[model samples]
Target: MKKRSLLFPALLCASLTTPSYAMLNGCVDTTDADKKTAVYFANGILTSPYAAENMAFKMGIAYKNQFKNLHEDSSYEFSDAYNYSQGKLTDIAQVLQQKMDEEGVAGISGYQIYELISSGLNNDPIRAVLAAFLSTTTNAIYTDALLEELGELMTSASVEAIADSLMVNSEHIGLYEANLIAGKRVLIMPHSQGNLFTNNAVAAVKTRQPDWADSIDYFGIANPAALTVGGAGYVTADDDRVIGILSLMENVLASNLDNDPSALPSFFGGDSRSNTNHLIVEDYWDARLASRAVIDTNMLRLAQNTPFPLQIAGTGAIRASLSWGGQPDVDLHAYEPNGRHVYYRSKTGDDGILDVDDTSGFGPENYTVACESVNAGTYQIGVNYFRGNATETAKVTVFLGDGRTITPRELMLNQAEGSYGNDNPATMFEITVTDDGEGNAIYSVQ
Candidate 1:
């Protein structure tokens, strides 16, 4: 239970922090395969996909403001990518609890966490379905009746988190490929769990395109990893509670943290007493000038290393981005005209893959047609209300890479209809394309 008590504050910082990027709320003064690309791969412990999205913009604004002050050229394409969604209080704790249960290692838990999870269970519908799917995926037995039982036990249980890590890291890697292939310089700064995602993505991308290394970079803020995946180094508070606690656990991968007796509290404001130091915006962001300087330094180096103007890898040849909230599970599906179907069940089809899926809530499950994989034909994209019925408002953004990246189709699903996204999904969008007479396919979203 000591772990439970210790975990509550860090958990509180994760789940309770609203979508404000600290003090830089300025009317946020305002991309492509060729624009200088900057992105924020956020930690998954957010309230919704929108929260993650907004946080990305806030981060961009904060950075842009600082970058302008530091260097003359402050133009860059900036966007946000949501980590796998765990929008509810219970969702995040469940992950933490499961980590401990599986590894039999103790770090974050106790009476306080018990209180948090107890209060969150009734409100969280996503984990039950998730448990059923995960359990069944592993050849275990999980009936509808068993879900309730498993749900209770899961407060103290955990699945092999490799699936979660894979889903998020792949999403990040996809962004890198999408942008870098588009001839854009990429800079991604990940916070907390995002450091892991960014690091993995960078390593993976570097492995694929070593010569492109100089074109991409990352800076970990409150970095939990001792090593920077494949980007610039990281800056972390000496007494960061989350980092401190994770460092002590064998099962948890985290950065080494050491407190300096004479270090000023203003620049690195991690407070063990208040337990409020885990938040990036409040703890670091631009508020901590010294650390902010570190981030800008990395940005400057990226500029020097990469001589491309800021560009956004927005909307690939065929991109389907789905986001929803207030429900446990809503799955995204893409039907390729090549007779290949992609969903959680069939995640990869042809060159299109469902790289990111959110069963926790506030999704952003995305399906992308690989950089050079656009076949001329009709592609159907849609969403299935997989579980929970709390009046889910699901939105889908289809980027045609032609001119319609902003066309969003929104749906209000009030019932949990299908367990698996069928050949023909309920909510849908259609994209039509024609191949060049010379054997190249050009597509557009209508």
Candidate 2:
């Protein structure tokens, strides 16, 4: 995986390395101090010192794209609705507004920064239009139900009132006092200091907000091992300098950040990598693992004198194979969900037959049955042709390919046959799968 230097070092040198601009009020400091500069021979032009500017632009584009995927209202306006349980964006917005009101900061700096970045990218005309709509209105909209809930959590004062207090009187740093006054209670990610607007603005919040001394919570979203050397910062969690911190429950999905498999820690479940914005979404795998119980209890019988749907189409070197591992051992078989045995075979000496496998002795081997383009979906995969356990747990892998080399399906089976096949022939067997549910297929029966 690629690595980035600590966010602070770059931030400290931003003013000296890049072009600096002064604001009318002289309140905002967009300066960079002199520091050691490195040169890259690949490009003749010197590297631009404006690190945060680039990140902001990229993050804005990502944010816009994510918003476009959501459902819209009757007029095609992306919903501004906020629900504590669902609309996370709206919730964050409300919180920011409430804090701003309490701190009495004129002209919402944080909101402006976030918007400047968002609008700067020019990816979404809709969002830009919406921002203009909100901008035109002088009164802040806190009509969402989530805003009410968050308001109740407040210490009996509105952010608007507190913001006024900070502007008029305060001995501490401007940002620190401002944050406490605004009722800042946001969860910040690590290595975020170089993000320009967010970093310095937060510092301003910390300095201006008195409550932050015992209200803030600090947390790291990345692995501790992933932290660059000397990256750790001191903040008293017990005293409220930092409130709480949690690891990436699965993978963090933000405007610009996604979990990369190459960057993942081995402890995370699944051979397949996933990226999610919320921890609840990341926890879905655990719920799935638990829900994988045998709801349809049926003994899987071998397909007999039947039309077995081979996943592969035209003839080549199509082969089917099955490999089994995990939990209890299970015999491989094939049938429909209604318990109709379609593929069954019999050994030269045995009375029962097998439907899917070509050779009984070729146990756990790749057997390519004749077939065609099997669309993606769940097909009946089973084990225990004649006599086998009714309720057994095992990991079965199916490999299918187009007549040549076999390709494996993404699904992994956890339970094979019912408790005991010999005792229960009326057992129900059906597994919900996706991706062309048919064709030349191999079963790795465990």
Candidate 3:
């Protein structure tokens, strides 16, 4: 697939007005006093030095408000990047504004300034003025030189440095202190192109500090990364322009769609393939809040090496998968109507079997009961923290034999009272079974 033209030309020329102060201020109100950290990477259009800062500030505000709504007490410490080339261009804007004033080009918008520069490049007299200013400031011969450097910085080595610096910075170091003192975690958030940059940065970090890999979590929004699957959660909107473009590029590269390129819609497209790891939302803001919820709910699980649980309900079978994050050794307990209890000790009963028993780390302990083996009575499904820490969130998903899936239910364990051999495990969902005409059991949620 052909790469789209660089978007910086339009973004750089579009606006110069500073973002609103409300959008650039850090959020103060939070639920938790022991603050966590967030390292954010701005989108591709944030070519200006202050753009990342502005984006981060706005995100901080959104997070604060959203977390407050969710009643989460914890707060985030934000870190971001400043584009050096964009900084130089912002400095040169002052000179360009003075020249515009001398030429009596009053009320010229930001785009008009770039237009003047583009036009001046061909006229000797105008070029002389720009050249003089460039020599005094950036030591560049022409406008193209600055653009080329900016493109290089955005597309090459500096991109990785931008991602790496987030981890090695004072905020990251502070994470260690906070973790030791207050048991806090770090969340790495990147939007759009920053997602790609973050993917590379994480790869680099794994090579450098292999041990710190489990200490951080990643939440990518509007991501363009092609092979994003492990160790991160991704959220993308159906109407996001960047996601649309990326979807187009992906289709083109894979040749999965029709060859007629003209048939493709310009915007508001959908991803060709559904990624289980990526959550699809309505828009950018939705993606942000959804990713935040995932992070907030699974912060303890994400900091450990536990794979996100996968639940699939097969025809003619009822399955229940119990999973949790953190160091809790959670167990799945299914009570059948025939007085048989299926658990780790008694893996199989007449109705079903506890197929997998995970005793450590992130668990996807599974219980499967054949529809034919089920009796016509109510079945109870619950989870027990057999060992380890008790105060962890447990996810229970019930799959009916009719190919319908119950929404995964989450239960917070009472850390104080939870322990092994606790028969009174928290009930997550109840399943009732009745015999269809031919002795085949049918299932329904009770």
Candidates' lDDT values, in order?
0.56, 0.26, 0.47
Model 3 clashing-pair count? 3
Model 1 deviation from native, Cα RMSD in Å: 17.1
Best by TM-score: 1
Model 3, span 364-399: residue lDDT tens: 577776544456665678777666644676666665
Q: Rank the candidates by lDDT, best first.
A: 1, 3, 2
Report the CA-based lDDT of candidate 2 relative to the real structure: 0.26
lDDT of model 2 at residue 424?
A: 26
As a whole number from 0 to 100, the lDDT of residue 216 in candidate 2 is 30
Q: Write the per-residue lDDT of candidate 2 for residues 222-274, one digit (tens) a residue.
A: 12112221131211111111111221211111221222223345476432323
Better of 2 and 3 by lDDT: 3
Give the per-residue lDDT digits (tens) of candidate 1, residues 95-151: 454343333333433233454454665524635334332323443555655756656
**What TM-score does each of the candidates earn?**
0.48, 0.19, 0.36
Q: Is candidate 1 or candidate 3 better by TM-score?
A: 1
lDDT of 3 at 197: 46
